[model samples]
Target: MTSTADIGLGTAELTKIFTTATRIKVCDEKFRSLILTGQVSAQYYSPRGQEIVSASMGAALRESDYMVTTYRGLHDQLAKGVPLRELWAEFFGRATGTCKGKGGPMHITHPASGLMVTTGIVGSGLPIANGLALASQLQGTDRVTVVNFGDGATNIGAFHEACNLAALWKLPVVFLCHNNRYAEHTSFEDGTSVDRVADRAAAYKMRGVRVDGNDPVAMHTAAREAVARARAGEGPTLLEAMTFRFFGHQMSDQNEYMKPGELESERANDPVLRFRAALIEQRVLTEPEIEAIEAQAKSDVKDAFEFAEASPLPELSELLTDVYEEV
Candidate 1:
């Protein structure tokens, strides 16, 4: 029952959130099209239902803040301001990519936008984010680091180690668990002992919050509070964002594991569409304005895809170039 006024976000902020969510949705649609058309042959994870979680979180941060995300991180990368052209080039394995076509979608690293690491390993980003936060603390910089992981990652040993260290040292890090209920093929009830992931934060004496990830206002408010706390030297916060992925774990997954009507129900409640309607109802944006925003996103994604297709692949000499650095 959170109203617009209670959300504490103005018209501009709401519009920004809607715009970001629309961009992510358009990019995702374009990506799936590429896969279906056989234009790209890489592993893909569709962030179909969890757009608002990343979009709102991204809107809460500054350009200088650091972020670490998982392999299923296209949404995270796009929301964090990774250039659409370079991102598409990387997907297409072109030399103009963030990693010069080496990393592909799983390992997108754009330091300029403070998206430092896109790790393929589960639970690995937590410790890396801690290291970045520690450096910021030692250097007396107020930079906050945000680490995004799935609910399954909470079971990893690194999760406990990172949380303990962050709390013990009061590091400026935010542990964001995109709890979509299912961990790969396993459901949360089957894999996790605890009902709520945020409840575990008590073991390390850190603040814990659980919010609806599909709601832009709720997600943004939680993220803003966590980021502000970290920046103000208040220490780390475990913010568990509850969401659901509309697609399966990977591109090839048929979602056979999902219960009857589960997928259909979630699709009917798509967050992107929900937010669009909310904005229009609040008078923050009109239907035509929203349509214009969507058109821009579509055009931008089309241009990026074309640019990627026209870009050249990495040279053979590149195999040995980034292997070792000179002293």
Candidate 2:
């Protein structure tokens, strides 16, 4: 475990990361439970093992900085400070959701929190992030834009195009790839040509880094440096966060494609649990404090669930509304 001090992260920051990750973990668990029991039904993609990656990356940005993420972005949304109630409401398709229940889980958007878009299409958010960064540049603000995607998105053409444009224009953007070692059911080795996704950054003349996404300290350090460089008008960075998903690609997937013992190994090294232990070991957080955090997360999730259940669904008229501007 890297010392938080060595990474320039104090106790407060570490606590925030742990708290965010815990909330995400708890939220994911609750969501899965809801689905299993038929309480809520939606196309869900579990971000179970990628909690620390989003938490640490989110810790590096300011509230005003922009972020774009993929459908598997509950962690990103939560880490970016989206209210638990609103997120749950959106997931539940309640009228009070961020998108007024029109977007559902895959399209959550909250501009107030700088979580601008949750795209369902793979590799689509990269160019959108570039647009946001270009806007910030034109407005003469230091606000950076971070786009989160899975390793599979890198194989798409948009990834290369966005990277080239971002580099050529020196856009203040960060291309964060959550490399969970699998693209849906396809293993990384079977799909990708490169040994490391970060290596592709060289082709576009951008800085690249590959770090242990499960390690809070290392993940935060890499994210912070990338964010700082972007804020200082440096070109974009390609950060490959190495991680693994404990669950299958989706809720129904049994991970039949994964080799035997792989899932078990990753689960045994669960990032959330590891981070919790590290916090206690480093004295950054006592066991009581950690328990308190976990308790609070559960309380928040419960409240959010209740709020979503109580809220009404969108009106039938809403189908016609928000479809087009009345110019």
Candidate 3:
């Protein structure tokens, strides 16, 4: 794996992104608790150590720009400035949810907040993002459409078709691929031949890059560049962020497939910790500042959970009615 040392982001900013990583950890711990306690039945993929890529990507976007996220989309939404109360409500299937309790955990839509919609299908969001970009391009708008997917998604037909059309039309889209080395227990080496997902960008004749997904500053800088290029009508860009998932593919997976010591190894190199270390090393932030950020994130998340627990589920009368419009 390539180190983040070569990426084009400032150490101080990268530290901010990484050091402020407790939100993701809080999410992970809460997710596990949810699963263990049977609060949620669906599968959960915790991007424990891979928070930098999604969070930084979200941080780089403008309010007008749109986003299409994947199943593992909580981080993306939170990073994009979605309110904790709304996010928790959505996860809890409450009327206050971004999708009004229709989309659940895997499906979240906050159009007003620029989150178009999140799909349950792995690579399905790519084509939707392409369409969004096409709409923007045809209408002569400068708004950029960004899409997020996992390493496993690259091999899917939806991903291929979306990229092909986006490149053909010179759409303003940035395809962010989070290569976490595994596609639900299946390692990348077992799945395909390509050493790096970014290398596949060459086949489309579009700009392709491989960056350390754990480095938030690097991700932010890269996303800025890609968005800039897209807005300038230079065409789409493919960014493959090399990251690692600290948890099993989903909540149910035994994760026996994970090599021994992998968890320990990744923990040592965690983006959040490393980023914090970098900040202190550079004298940009002190220990108290880092602790304050973490404490706030935790307090915020705790409040969200409490709100979600208190929020009522959708009523039966409304559920049967929202499926179709009477008019």
Name model 2 segments beyond 4 Å from true.
none
Candidate 1 per-residue lDDT over residues 1-327, each given as its tens digit? 147887668988888888888888999999988798987898888888999999999999999999999988988998899999999999888999998999899999999999999998999999999999999999999999999999999999999999999999999999999999888898888899999999999999999999999999999999999999999999999999999998799988888888899889999999999888888887778999999999999999999999999999999989777758978
Ten residues in a row with the worst lDDT in model 1? Answer: 1-10
lDDT score for residue 172 of model 1: 97
Best by lDDT: 2
Residue-wise C-alpha lDDT for candidate 2, range 1-327, written one tens digit per residue = 587767678999999999999999999999999998988899999999999999999999999999999889999999999999999999999999999999999999999999999999999999999999999999999999999999999999999999999999999999999999999889999999999999999999999999999999999999999999999998799999999988788899999999899999999989999999888888899999999999999999999999999999999988878878999
lDDT of candidate 2 at residue 180, scale 0 to 100: 97
Write down the RMSD of all candidates, one decimal each.
Answer: 1.0, 0.8, 2.5
Of candidates 3 and 2, the better by TM-score:
2
Q: lDDT of all predictions, in order shown?
A: 0.92, 0.95, 0.81
Question: Which 10-residue window of candidate 2 scores lowest in summed lDDT?
Answer: 1-10
Off by over 4 Å in 1: none
**CA lDDT for candidate 3:** 0.81
